[model samples]
Target: MDVKKVLIAVDNSTCSEKAARVGYETALQFGAEVALVNIVEPVPANVNPDLTLAPVFLETYDNSKENSDMLLKEIELKFAQGTKTTYLSTVDTAAHGIIKQAEEWAADLIVIGTYGRTGLYHFLMGSVAEHVARKSACPVLIIPNKWEED
Candidate 1:
C-alpha cells in the first residue's frame, strides 16, 4: 500500500512506544508523514452530591491528559532520529477517539498497541485495538505487547 499519512496512538506503556517506533520507521521507509496521537482517557462524571469527589475526579482527568502529552513528546523525540512528526492529543474514550481522529485527519494508516490480555481480562476490559481494527476505515495495525522473534 502507498501509505500517505500514518496515525499512531500512544500511551505510557512500552507497547505504545513499540507501536510508535514501528509506525515511525514505516513512515520513513514509505515516505509518509506520521502523527503521534495520544488519547487522554476521560473520567466519568460525578452525579452525586458529595463535593469531596470533585478533587479526585479532576486530578485524575488532568493527570491523564498530562501523561498523554508527555508520552507523545517522548515518542516524538525518539522518532526524531528519522521522522518529522506531528503530535496530536484528545480527551475521550480511547477507541472511539482514535477512529474519530483518523477520520478527521484523513490518515491512511492507523497504528495502535494492545496489552495482549485475553480470556477473562480481555472479556472484562474489552479490546481497544480490536475495536479500532473493526471500525477503522483505514488499515489498522495492532502491535501486541509480546514480541515475535521474527
Candidate 2:
C-alpha cells in the first residue's frame, strides 16, 4: 500500500523516542507527511483526596501539556526535515486519542512505542501499542523498547 501519510504517537519515555525515530525513518522512506501526536491523560481523581487541592491538579495538568508540547517540538525539529509535519496534543487515553487522530488525519500508517509489558504488569497497565494496533483503521507499527542492533 502507498503510505502517503504517517501518524506518530509519542510520550515522555525512551521507548517513545525510539518509536519517533523509526516513524521518521519510515516516513522518509515513503516520502510521507507526518503528524506527531502526544496524549496527556488526565490524572486519576483518587490521587488527590482533598477537594481543596484542585488548583494543584490544574497546575500539574498545565505543566504536563507544556512539557508535551516541548517534547513534540523537539521531535519535529529533529526528524521532520523535508516533510510536512503537524504537532498535536490531546487529553484522553493515549491509544484512543492516537487512533482518533489517525482517522481524522487520514493517516495511512501509525507508529507507536511499546514498553513490552506482559502478565501482571500488562494486566494492570494496559498496553497502548497493543490497543492502537488492534483498533486503528490504518496499519500500526509498534517499536519495542529494546531493538536489535544493526
Candidate 3:
C-alpha cells in the first residue's frame, strides 16, 4: 500500500525514542507526512475508593500532560524539518489515543514501540502496541526495544 501519512506514537521511554528514530527514517525514505503523538493517561476515577484522592488525581494528570507535551516537542524537534510533520498530545489510553489520532489524520501507517513486557508485567499492564496492532485500520509497525546486556 502507498504510505502517504505515517503516525508515530511515543512515550517518555527509551523504546519510544527508538521508535521515533525508526519512524523518522521510514518517513524520510517513503516521503510520507509524519505525525508524532504522545498520550497522557488520565488518572482513573476510582483510583481511591475512599473518594479523597481527587486532588492527587488531578495533580498526576496535570503532570502527565506536561511531560507528554515535553516528550512530543523533543521528538518533533529532531525530525520535523524538511518534511510535513505534526505534534499531538491527547489524554486517554495510549492505544486509544494513537488509533484516534490515526483515524483523524487518516494515517496510512502507524509506527510505535513495544516495551516487550511479558508474563506478570504484561498481564498487569496491557500491551499498548498489541492493542493498536489488533485494532488499527491501518498497518502498524511495532519496534521492539533492543535487548540490553545487563
Which candidate achieves the best TM-score against the true structure?
2
Q: Candidate 2's C-alpha lDDT?
A: 0.88
| Tens digits of lDDT, candidate 1, 67-144 | 877778888887757676787788878899999999998899998989999899999999999999999999998898
Query: What's the TM-score of every candidate structure?
Result: 0.86, 0.87, 0.83
Best by lDDT: 2
lDDT of each: 0.86, 0.88, 0.87
Candidate 1 global CA lDDT score:
0.86
Give the worst 10-residue stretch by lDDT in candidate 2. 44-53
Q: Model 3 clash pairs?
A: none
lDDT of 2 at 80: 76
User: Once model 3 is optimally superposed onto the true structure by TM-score, how far is the C-alpha of residue 44 displaced, in angstroms?
Assistant: 3.4
Q: Rank the candidates by lDDT, best first.
A: 2, 3, 1
Pitting candidate 1 against candidate 2, the one with the higher lDDT is 2
- Candidate 1 Cα outliers beyond 4 Å, as residue runs: 47-60, 148-150
| Residue pairs that clash (backbone atoms under 3 angstroms), model 1 | none
